[model samples]
Target chain A: MTAPAAVLDSPLRELSYAEAIRDALAIALAEDERVVLMGEDIGVYGGAFQVSGDLVHRFGEERVIDTPISELGGAGMAVGAALTGLRPIYEFQFSDFATLAMEQIVNQAAKLRFMLGGAVSVPLVMRFPAGSGTGAAAQHSQSLEAWFGHVPGLKVVQAATPYDAKGLLLAALDDPDPVMLFEHKLLYKTKGPVPEGRYTVPIGKAEVCRTGSNVTIVATAIMVHRALEAAEVLAQEGIDAEVIDLRTVRPMDRETVVASVAKTSRLVVAYEGVRTLGIGAEVSASIVESEAFDYLDAPIVRLGGAEAPIPYNPELEKAAVPQVADILSAVRGVVRGTR
Target chain B: MSISSETERCGAQAPAPGRKGSGGSARPASRRAGKTSAGNEPFAVRHYSPEVLREALRKMLLIRRFEEGAEDSYMRGLIHGTMHLSIGQEASAVGACLELTDQDKITSTHRGHGHCIAKGADVGRMFAEFFGKESGYCRGRGGSMHIADVDKGNLGANGIVGGGIPIAVGAALSAKRLKTGTVVTSFFGDGAVNEGSFHESLNMAAIWKLPVIFICENNHYGMSTSVERSTAVRQVSDRAAAYSMPGVTVDGNDLSAVAEACHGAIERARAGEGPSLIESVTYRWRGHSKSDRNRYRSKDEIDAWIARDPIRRFAGLLSEHGILSEEGFARMETEVAEQIAAAIAFAKESPDPDTAALTRDVYTTQTESVG
Candidate 1:
């Protein structure tokens, strides 16, 4: 079950990121009786973002429960259920609402096992439909993966493509500790090839989506696609840019980023979070702290979200976060030794 | 009277008149009189067997001694950090857990030593945890505030107020989903009632009809602020009506009173009747913590509560019923004292945890090589 042998022989089919996540949920529900799907409006209403479409009907309301609009209570219940015997997969309607449940996420779920001297493990998975792009305004569109990444007992992961989304969601179920999967709302409709059966992508592992040598562009979630597009444009101008998608943020894939930085000699971190104290800062710190610092030919550049909150206006929301143009300009600046 | 009517009667009299005296003993004498009589042999004395009653008294004594021993150790500088002592709230802890078996689960508060002991945790390991020894419940990772014996069905004692409320509801949810036949009792104070987690958790439990008992050990103050100053509702249990669950308030100092209320709630929960709110109205004799100066309340109020000490009252009740003699009670106290002394010695002798294994239990599986 650990290896993707079924994935190898099974016919590959294109699935939207949301559909892929739903597939993983369906597979988990069918395979394990202990797996329960819980969230607000996830039952007959098909979830807030329609990620869990018709799961409650197929799995029964008892298994795929529609909890009251109580994030803190619901999340804490998932943690408690995980502690005892159940493997609960909880979904937050939007990542911004996580602030309401931070006590359970940060204090209880993250620290329960450690606080109890490893006597118990919380095999809890929380899916957050994160990032801005939808005109959901300041409350619902902010990218807060960095907040969970800062926690010690949590495993934070971001899936850029449909394949990784399903694979990572499956891997999170296999994990014993609490794993937080940050699924970007913008990428939910994006299509990619996903396997038919159960398969897991290792947490804390980065994938080099596009390989080059002039500069390394480290990105996560939606920014990974932007960085890849920027790399394609950079290749046309004879500048070879490497794009590395940092899958996990807490137990960060520092070795992969460090090695990529060592080979490229210049680094550009592109993320959708705020500029200060964001994922970019952590990636940059890992590079400088490692032996890869000696290979640097230019100062590192970070293409992150603006310091302001995500606005209701589409243009302002697009300007608030990094786009393909921002990643391209940042990578060009790093490669040309201008940053 | 029926248990429901009795609960309603007590619930209506909450914030018991003359609770705050003007520099003198304003204790409510009528509420504490004739609790144990030949005809009305309190709920626990009548319902429980003589052996169970004896055990309940023993556990109540153990809780009291454990807190006293912990306080003594802290005073001697043997235990580091601060502790919220539950010295005077022993009956609420023990009575509420009187019917619970080893398989039953409980989530405790910061002042949780009583709950931990009542739920059958070894005192030796609890002491070792206070000493920060490797042989402790949490292997020195969690001290007094976070002590837990998971295998014995104690989830943990939460440092944050109302933090364990939702977790307890979740545990009850697991019990219902997995058909584990486990009922979870979540212990929090009066102050935690105002927390959003409390309201949210109660509503969830009530809606799902989960087998959980929400035990509020209403010891007046959340640190220094009294319930009257902090809470809008007169009684903590009164808030239960909002969530559509049966709410009851009992004299927490009376072992049978608390046990009776909790027994009804626990039985209701196990029968798939959903959750019930039980407010065990008691008081803490000592200051909230070691740093407290007792400035918030008068010494007379503290003295008045001490006069109605749960352990003494329970012991006297047992003697009055011919379940245990006065000499037997003295022997029980001596036995608990010796046990506590032995526990302290074991804790002092326990080995310190190696610094190298500091981060060993942070994650069950080593996902990352980096700290």
Candidate 2:
């Protein structure tokens, strides 16, 4: 058996988003006996997305538990276990299944602490395989991080990079309130540098993925990748597009986005969630609500998924959310003042 | 009071393992309050002493008076939000907690004031919670349905139907995993039995044999809809057969029957015999909520259920057993009324929650680390 990965400060080896999450799970299981993975098809199936691969064999069925296909029951049990001594990480095969567990998540988990006057807490973690482009259609491909972020007493984070994928999970495990961690379905196989052993990426912080001056593209999940790609293309056109990967949607890094918009004087918010009441509106409002409003050179362009439910067809699906080309066109329009 | 008469009323609905009754048996709890304790034998048939009987009556009485006061205050514009009172279903609520302690956990329904009181919640603080004051259990953030005293083993009541069912299963899971010797009871409305959570949680609990009891307070109606109209199944407990668990339906208006049934189920759960379901057939005396103007049910139907008021039946049982006299019952009534009145005054005098407290309890640590 491989020795549990050692703690190394220096970055070494690259892992895909799926592998990074598994590494974090291994660390959590090995380090803390109280941690358990509760979800459907996560154990023998190695997870529907294969994110929990091989850990079930190592941790045993008790720690890496397989649950019935009842999202409401599984999620509620996770919350209840958290209220007890156990730190349970619940997984939804798809983010859309969270609709079934909304009563437990929104009503029970979110309100338990406040309802009890802070006597007890639900130190629970819920993972969702979110975002579109898999052609999983409307039910499986939704990015519902905004729905969770809208609720109080919940910490919602989107892991874009492999480093943050592992680090943010470890951090959420440390949190006392229920935290919802959203991993983009499209970014599962995407690989990036991840440190060895356990490490934590601070929640509610945004990282500047690519620095530029013409426009600041604040993106989440898979949108961060599209924004970075668009920045690369715009760099050749003498349009230096700054990219800010907004990792956590709730308690957003308003200071960083506002500061970036102040410097670039233009902003383009990108996300895979529906256009109405998406994170884009909040980011734009935060900037407008602050001193960044006066520094805006152009109206903030919100690039979100289409208002309609995603069609099964791949072409229509591609048209739903902002792509690299769409980001480029929006950035070009704001930079050239053509709109 | 006699064995033959007791059997006549409760039938074979007790959780005696081998006991079974005809499907949908509706036993009318004796509405006659004059049946005094003279004809009953003491300490021979039941183990509970005269003191325990008095205490049970007292607890149910307190719940009744407290909720009545809350209703009065609501009408007077003192209690702000709406409250769902279990006035007529006190036995089903209190009887489930007869054998439970702080080591045990109970998740209650929206009509959970009785459950909270029966489980030893402070009446003053509960009143404060209903009034939305700082001294309440939730510090005024959560209203009637969300009121909780976790230290007392009362998990907060849920507003959503069937929401607390899974949490109870999870708690049972924790007890089993930790070997804590703790048991959990989930008290939900009849409507919740139809929800997916109820089915899923029951299945999981039965398979694990985790010490948990699913108690369905079958109050005959969910909001305005009758159980017969809403659900296809004739009996709520029959669903337990799907999970391979023992399902018992008892006369909820009879406190002794509820106690006997819950005590056995809880003991079996604690013995690692998995979960069981108890469908306590009862009725609600009040409207579903403040907005419920009693438009759906006729006054005659409401009067019939009110005739079967659980508090009155228990009072009759105690009187029939010779444990309670007319003067003794009257003194108990006055005592409960004063206690409720004091609680109301306490809630009225309590300060409003500090606005600064609203920011707290959101997370365990760190506001937002920008770096």
Candidate 3:
């Protein structure tokens, strides 16, 4: 597969990664009356990160509501709106702050439809800016995608590029169940070629960013970029390692994973969340429990953050999360096998 | 601590049942007249007409009976989940809910049967929920604590102590944004007033002027801890002033008083005056939950609050006004009993949810395949 030949032919503009999100929001709101952006400080304050810059001014306050610092209240309100025939795109100021609203997300909004016996659908999207940066410390910096993926009813997506951000967001709005979109705080300034017109990427499919045969490196969120960098380093050593972005974590792209395992016979799962019960666990367990187990010549390797709480100190925080160097070493170890 | 203070005659000295001086040893109507005349004049109360009063009485009795029946089932080992009975505090739920329009919404507490009946949930479906049948409001997945019907404006009963407060405020926020003209009433016990969500929600509602009524049913105890011990301020309503909103305390045992207080707050909220808090002073006749032994209180105290029983008091007023005779009371009881029995029968006959449906409503995916 030669990568679908860049379906978007428009000249790529030099927009910040955050501008791409705003552009995506502008397009969605301009195209559909049902789409609305809601969050704390997103309106008059242009979002805490300014991702929704000028959206309230552009779409008016009715469409872009600046909510109080009540995550649970705002999330529940979004759930109510979504239930009442509206597509509500909710923003948590920071992903770490999402813990305050867990009751609404995990208990009510996530389970309402299923509890109602298929009679209702919560067509809602909750976007949380995740990962460590800007010295936000323990309460703000967390790669918590695994916590949401652990849930049964929610679809969790982490888009690495600007194109995936726009496409994944649109797809999330189109999804009937609640979709959790984890946007990395560090990736907001990075930009890429995003389609100008409306386009959607299927939610539960994984994109193999690079193809190789020596080893399979699966990563998510910021770790996807790190894995890509590691893939280049491994290739320089004549070790062709395949890199797969497990974009959607809940209904995981197991077929792509199994296929990669069959080709390489070595697997390395990387994530930024804690090591235990993280996406790595799910990916590793899936391979062992499936037909892919027979094709694996070596044991599957898993790499993730430490189990301790995210530290405020910059050095400890860096040590807690996986880096490009970590990915390179993990990939090499998997390729070299038990030695 | 003399009982002869001018405020004492106005029912202000009516200690919670089973508390100190809670026995009905106080002098009769003679003392009540003197107390009520001096201190009660300032607190405006709306009186219901004889016919209207009788109907409200009927509703309260229905809630009491329904809960008692649920307790019976729980004791017999028929119900799978824990049951929280609103036995003593029926008037607060029934009285306040009666003031709401059909389109008005409410978020309920764990002890929610009273709110469900007052908000017009189908008794059969409520019974079905207790029975764990597929025909229940939540299709058996929500059991008791999560029974919800969006159509009926009953958002749902929550299991968390102050969980429903934020949700109800959210619904009110939606109503304000959508111009739905629907005001939400969030019912929680006095204990929930101490929760951070309670303050957060009230502050938000006040700032936005959202159409919501925060109804705190001060049933004296929050699962065995008295409100006085848990809170420094005497009444939960006083906290409303912190948000710059009006606060009122009403006699929860009086159905007319509760209805009027809630009615005023709802009207003000709909008029865009923002949210208000109404602290209804009531008692929970039963323990916090079905399994609680209620060793914290005395028998005499329970007997004291029983003297101010909402249903009986309202019924007495109705009879005194010639609105209901002995025959009418008998007829109402018979009708209530028959209705409850029919609901039980309907729930029993209703089939259990298919085992395959266990994974059905978990998500909105088109894949009919099971997880």
Candidate 4:
């Protein structure tokens, strides 16, 4: 029998982003009885994507409730439990399924606080494995963070690394407003250091994964990791590329991005969401709106998924979302003729 | 109660016409005291206990006072948002809630002040909610439509029409699975029965045998459309037969009858009897919200239903039972008036929530957060 993975390792131990998220949830549930997980096939089935693998055995069905295939129902149930003082961590089988529960998330959960004259809150965290990489096609693959980010009463976050996946989820579970945590399906296998003990990565705070003086590259979810890879390739070409992981999309850490752009003097925003009105557009506009635009060495570049439905074909799906090569090209183009 | 010249209210006394009964009887004029322009009438009465009778009267009066006060504040522009008043259908809320233990939970609708009060929420906090003050149950984050006092087992007053049904089903599932012996009662309107959530939740609850009581307050209209126009079966209770649950129609205006029906269902549920459906035939005295000037019904219909006022009927029963004399009933009314007056004063005097609190409780901090 394979023994369970070690938990006492240093915070930097290599682990898949999905494992890291599971670790974070385990630590959270172990620490508090109020924290419970609810979603379709999250328990006995070990999650459709296995993000909640082995949780049912550890927490039991009570803590890790396996619900019916009712997205709106599950979302509404989460809102109810949250309002009743339970910290509910709800999971959407896929980000695309979130559309079915939009009324609960957007109308009921999101607007509850504001409409109630700011009297009550929905202390709920909903995790949706988002973005296109797996040939899950249009219904299952869509980076719809912009849809949730546009809602005023909801906090939206996306995790690119094993570290942020674990930490941001922990943070989202703590927030009183409904929080939508977008996890890139492809990033699950990627490992990074995740602290063993309970800790939270603050929401709405951007992480500067790699520092450079040439160009500020702001990216979200899987795009953050791709940007980091592009930054590494850019470094070899004598082009210093700074990568900003937009861990939280709503109540975005604009200050961090603006400060980075002020130092780097060039900005490139990237995301897996569609190009039009996506997180990329929001970040680019923020840069132009801020005092940092005066220091821009070139026009702020925005790179995002093609403005089309995610295709079923593998090659088309790969081309739809920004890849390392695309980021590298975009960054190299921005840094060109600057010197 | 005496009307004061200082207060200018929206509704004026008008004789309602064409108010037909479920069985096609001519509506009584006295029952139409304050029916909104929608010619809806109060349903027939059920059995009443002496104590239950008084309790229902008090609660309904409380709702009436609360709504009257809310409308006053709303007209004055002191209340910021829209207020949905359950002025005429208090018996349904109180009667159903009476069957619930403190452990049992209720999911309310957008027009939910009556549900909150019946579920035992503090009147002061409810008032503070409308005032958008910090003392409100949600600390000003949740207003009237979202008031939730978990301690009182009121899940919340939902803003979306059919939103709370699923939550109640989940809570019922939790209760049954956890063996908590706590049933969940979901209060929605006839309008909500048409929602996809209503059907989905009912099917899930039935299949799971989750302990839930789906109380549809068929108050004759969903916003403006009459139940007759929307539903082929005039009696909303008939839908319960579709889910294979015992469907019973109760006089929502008669407090005792509602309590008896709910008590049987609640007891059966606690004993693992699965779920039941109770369609409370009722009417609304006010418009859907404070802003509505209901033009759907005639003056005769409005005047007719007011005559069958639940509060007045319950008071009459108490007098007939010799539980309380006319003077004693008057004293109860006076006490309720004073209590409500104090609640209003308390809300008026309560401090507003600090602006910084707007960001707090959105997430539980490690130092201050939940998880």
Candidate 5:
């Protein structure tokens, strides 16, 4: 059930997660005439995070459309375009803005194909800059990947690294169904080696970011980066924590996740979203419902964001989601039987 | 709030109460602003050749017979799932799509069978879809509310009221960007115009000058709630002013009038003048769904609208003009009835979907990396 590591041979470039996403968009735009970008302030404004810098000039305003400040309308247009012939990549200023366009995303884009008896496919990509730590407060900072993953037709993924941010975006664009790509706001500036040119990391395969034996920590979005950092700290403490970066939340690679859990009996699900009914719950259930259940040596634990809105206060924002120290301690507790 | 607006006193094809057309008394002093004098005229359909009018009549009749057939089948329990038939609003559906080429796209509402038929969908597959047959357009996946033919440029009908508005705008955006010369027609109902999606889509389309025609089939009800109960504006087209687009209200039962208004709007879109909103005020003779009894509406109200049946009115026009003889009209009606009958037979004989289909079409197991 294990997939080969998606190691690209193209020229390696150190790019931030935001830069990798922009590059992937540029590649998709250049390679195909059907692809177009639409979002608020993404064109001349260089995006909220400057992710799509100068794309307006390069692709022109036609292909790189600067839509009116209407998320619902823009998302609906993207669905319509996807329903017709063109492939549209829509961007939400923040993941929270998606709430305004929930009807379009949930009812229209997600259900069009199935509702139409599979007569058409909505080959649409929606980019959501999600997660917290920027002190954007309750309205701005939120992880709603689980909300979209809960839908039957949507392909929900959390791009953890620059390589994945680029590769997953391309993969999502290529996917025949609607794909919700959630990029953590904090990871925009985090740099990693990303391959150049046309390449994609298949959706639904969880990659083992840091392979270990004592415990398995399934992390999503920014938590994967945090889990990797926590793994380094746990390595020094003699606890080898296997970190599985759950790239895609839905159509979950249960086989890969179960295999990791079977390999490492102790399991810890880490996510920045709220713990209740989150991706962590799904991951926890995946192992509990399978043969991996009998292999569990201890009660599987979950370390996720607290059941509270992300506060504007920096300290509270840091406390909201599981930080490296929290992930490190959670794994330590599960591994050393400290409870 | 009263469900009736000042202009809600008449049926789709009826002349405004106490108001006349071009030859009648001068336009009302208190007449709702922004509506054109030309939009109130029913003779616009005569501007086209008799041939075009005959085809428009044929299209409307086809929708009428098709829905009647569907209704019969539904009653017989041959159709599994429920459907929203455009029984009384045939003119709006036909006229909106009357002039559209195969390259142009359309998105319909839950009451979309007429839209699909107008867009050249094969009735056999459409009936098959309603019967949940393997041969249906959606292969039994999308039933009545979900029938779509991408090849015919029908983007499929939406279950949500204002759902198709944005999609039509998107198709227009695609057309504008690709220089495809493809205009998109969006067909919704009175209830949909109030939806936030309508406002957002109109604003975007107006600003971008996307080739989109927004046809609001104002059937006087969003389920059971009337326009006065739902909207602040008297005419659904009045909302268009907020988005800087041209808006009009036309008699939806008059196919020629609906066709003429849509023709202007479609041409305006193709010419890159931006989107236009046309409120084709019509009525649904039937209930909202299979379960909906006529509790909210009075029997008199239903009878009044039914008297202005779009197909019957169009047939009268064609007959009056000598474009279609009485015999020809009867023959067309009989042919459509036979077509529906054949479709039902095809659906009844078709096999149920295999178990493997359960796991199929769900973007199954893609391991290949995109290059």
Candidate 6:
């Protein structure tokens, strides 16, 4: 299936991924009085990645709150605020720092509504600046979206393009449940055409970035762009590789992957997290567990991060995660039925 | 030493009950006096009307009886999971919530049955939750530790020791931002005072000038660990000074004293003066939960706390003040007992949740349904 073309009501403007996110925050704050932004260094600091640039100035300090260096307390505060009447968007300085606030995110925010027998819904959104590329070492650089996706009652999404970054964020605000948005750091400066007005991209749906028939390449976050690059290389070699960008991780778009796999007769699941128990495993299991299992022409290939922390050295950092070359080779192997 | 002996020492130092018609006033009295003495009137007796005092006594009795009934059911093997009984610490819960209305929010700890009752939760629904029935407060999804009545401003009780502290601060933030005029009270045990969340929440609430009251129910122990062993400060309230908030330590078993301390803190919060910490020094007669074997304390200590039961002390004080007659006290006890019995019967007759609808509340959208 092809990606849905958004209706062009307004002129398209070029926006970096970070600018698009800031635009969404500004829009949310302007439209709803309940929307509040909370994080460390978010106010005046323009956020760690400048994704919330100039929002504090435009919305005031009360709305773009700068919380203390208390991740557990700050996250729980967002949960509490969301539980009440406020719609809070909490940003973790770095996705790796989410380890400090796992209790509130997992135990409280993820299970509060279900535990309370649906008495209340947590309309909370958490922004995580994730993935490795810059010299952030092991602690600062990590793709932890799969960790959040494993939990129920949480909507986890990764917006590869600037268009989806703003659209998915707006959609997450409309959601009643807690949504964890993982914005890749490398994609922050990447510019794309985005709508000028408010728009929403449906969550829990995967978009077909490229169409082919030899093999289906399922990718997430930064890997989506890498798989698209690999698809171009594969097409030159007479390998028609279909690329599916999985937008949401928790409520995964399994139908698109399954239908694509059934047509291509091969699968290559690419993700930035570790290979074992990562989203790739879920995608692979979803296809094998479905009727698409009968259409497999060869064993499914998984292109994932190496079983080690993201190193400080540039070369090791690049080696730690799957690159376009790795996706190209993995897709080639799956299409050619080679071990 | 032992927390019970420390609690006993504090109990011995408490002032004698005030005489009737000595200092009773309809207007709200200043709590600057801190501790009531023989010359000064007891805070509740001096501040509240006879009707409010009578209702306070009734709620105190109801808390004690409800825990007793719950214990009875647990012993009879009717209830499944273990429960944290607030049997002896009823005064702290009832007194702290005495001035709260439906608009005010409260976050409770593991031993939160008293808080739930004090916050006006239905006893039948609470019991039904314990029985894992469909008609319970959480519809049987949240059992004893997570019971909540959002409409009554009772955020659900937390299983983690210090989990609810930050949540209460957030609620207060909401109240201040939305101009709801609602004050939030966070209730936790002595153990929670040492948690990082406690200190962080206190600091945030102070800086934000949020309308929140931190009520530390110093039951002397967080499970098996005593306050003296766990906490560095002399009293839990002393830590509030770090956050630039007024801190007070009161005899938690004394209903009037606990009520008086909380009244001041609640007033301070409502006025947007920022958060205040009140450490209610009390003891639990029962072991921490159903699994406790009383290895931490002695039988003598338990008996001493039982003798200083909050319900008995409050009833005796009410009787001395001519607010409740001995006959009226007995009638109240009988009535509370009947209510508990009826609640249990309702729970027994209530239907269990259907297995097919197990994942009904996982998400509001119901996009992907699977248990």
How do all models score by TM-score? 0.95, 0.91, 0.90, 0.84, 0.92, 0.95
Q: Estimate the lDDT of model 6.
A: 0.86
Better of 5 and 6 by lDDT: 6
TM-score for candidate 1, residues paired by index: 0.95
For residues A1-339, what per-residue lDDT tens digits would candidate 5 score against the true structure? 211344455558899999999999999989999999999999999999998898998999888888888999899999988877798999999999999999999998887766665666889999999989888999999998899988877889998989889889998988889999999999999999887777788888889988989999999888887888888888888888898998998778788889998999989999988899888889989899999999999888888889999999999889888888888778878888898
Candidate 6 chain B lDDT trough over 10 residues, lowest sum: B18-27
Tens digit per residue, CA lDDT, model 2, B261-327: 7776888888999888888888788989988998888998878777666677677667766778877
lDDT by residue (A113-184, candidate 2, tens digit) is 877777788999999999889988988889899999888888899989998999899989988889899999
Candidates by DockQ, descending order: 1, 6, 2, 5, 3, 4
Query: What are the chain B TM-scores of all models?
Result: 0.91, 0.88, 0.87, 0.85, 0.88, 0.91
lDDT comparison, 1 vs 2, better candidate: 1
DockQ, candidate no. 5: 0.50
Top candidate on lDDT is: 1
lDDT of 6 by residue, A1-339 (tens): 112345365678999999999988998999999999999999999999998888889999999999999998999999999998999999999999999988889988998898888999999999999999999999999999999998998999999999999999999999999999999999999999988768888889899999999999999988889998888888899999899999999799888999999999999999998888898899999989999999999999888888999999999999999999898878777777665
| DockQ computed for model 3 against the true two-chain complex using alpha carbons | 0.46
After superposing the true interface residues, what Cα RMSD does each candidate give?
1.0, 2.6, 2.6, 5.1, 4.2, 1.4
The local lDDT score (0 to 100) that residue A70 gets in candidate 4 is: 81
lDDT of each: 0.87, 0.84, 0.79, 0.77, 0.81, 0.86
Residue-level lDDT tens digits of model 5 in B133-238: 8888888877898888888999888878788899899888888878899899999888887788988889888888889988888888888898878888777777
Task: Provide DockQ values for all models, in the order shown.
Answer: 0.82, 0.54, 0.46, 0.25, 0.50, 0.70
What is the C-alpha lDDT profile of model 3 across B1-371, one tens digit per residue? 11112122223435333322211211132112112443343121334555655667778778887887888877787688697888877778877887687788898988888998888878888888888889998887777777777678887788888887877776786677678888999999989999877887888788879888988988888898988789977567768878887777767776655676677778888999888887877888888886789888888777777666767656654554566787888788888889888888898899998997788778877542412
Return the clash pairs for model 1, or none.
none
Off by over 4 Å in 2: A1-11, B1-45, B325-327, B356-359, B364-371
State model 4's lDDT. Answer: 0.77
- The digit string of per-residue lDDT tens for model 1 on B239-318 reads 77898887776678877877877887788889998998888878998888889999999988888777667777777667
Each model's chain A TM-score: 0.98, 0.97, 0.96, 0.94, 0.97, 0.97
Ranking by lDDT: 1, 6, 2, 5, 3, 4
- Give per-residue lDDT, candidate 4, residue A271: 90
